[model samples]
Target: MLTVDEHGLTVSAPWRSSERRIVGVIRDAEDWVLKKLDVWNAFPARKQTWTQDDRIRYLGRDLSLELTQDTIASLATLRDGDRLQISLADPTHTDSVKAAVVKWYRRHALANFIDRIGALAPRLEVPVPRLFLSSARTRWGSCNARREVRLNWRLIQAAQPTIDYVVVHELAHLLEMNHSRRFWKIVASVAPHYREACAELNRMGLYYMDI
Candidate 1:
């Protein structure tokens, strides 16, 4: 299998697969590989400065960061529907500001993902699997044989439909473990527009890379 993320291309093959065979595969898919690499290269690397008025992405919208100092406690909150207000003992400290904002994202991500899983799992006639937050850079979500699902916390920055598609995709694994036709059929049953959602999520993947 070949995967592309912010880092570039990765090829996964059987242990005994020969280097020549791998090179042949990549050669056959050269155009596709190059296109994906070009897309990543087109987007400038994202680096959060944690400064006031900085733009933060949440739920497909850009919210400006509002910084303030509070000697009592450090906290982050959404205000006026378009601002993420982060209050800290030292608001000028970049690390503290970033930490507070990330904490808020994780907290909200857990609640949101749990709700999605709970609602979607039953549609597939499966019990809601255990959900956990992940910080992985290359993948959005994963499921294991133990019926546990781990989703990237950065998904909180995506729209609700996109999030639901991922939830259904992972929950479908309970019935079909691989990306076979049956598995995709199961996904489509619950999320008819999953193809569009998949494309949107891919775009967001690069956008959320550094954040």
Candidate 2:
């Protein structure tokens, strides 16, 4: 298992494995681990410098963020086609642009999550859980004991299938909180191709997408 934090990862080994073997393994994989960490660290800097060439993914499609200025009259930022049209006192202001983009993501994330959960909950024969969109950096989704499901707004950048997996995964938790075999069985029942979807989500990697 991977235990990660500000210090990066700590490789947890099987109970039967020796400490020496685990240390040797970590040492051997050190270079690759460092490279992955570097990729995560570099993205925040890139996200801050939002040039027209910058990209954002929507429903798994990568689209360039083309910023347009509107000085004719004051208007709220709006999306037309795949780009954002910003109207404000300063169109080039980084903070204002970022805020508008974030607002757009939040609006879409809530709508998409609600749609997916509304569709799947009926299939499971469970009452629809209250949905909440989160800005969590690492977690994609979570379900509390209250049956409230929280999905990361950044997931709006992923594909529809990936979003379905996360929704179904959390819905299954309404039946089983722990990640047991029974919990996975519920997930499989609701989403038959969940295994493939989960693998795709892993390969996509969370940190690669800027929130």
User: Which candidate has the top score in TM-score?
Assistant: 1
lDDT for each residue of candidate 2 in 2-113, tens digit (9 for 90 to 100): 4332224657677799988988888888888877666545533334455454666677776666666776653434356565554555657877667766777788889999
Tell me each candidate's TM-score: 0.87, 0.72
Worst 10 residues of 1 by lDDT: 3-12
Clashes of each: 0, 0
lDDT of each: 0.85, 0.72
Q: Which ten residues in a row are the worst by lDDT in model 2? A: 1-10
* Alpha-carbon deviation at 118 in model 1, angstroms: 0.5
Query: Which candidate wins on lDDT?
Result: 1
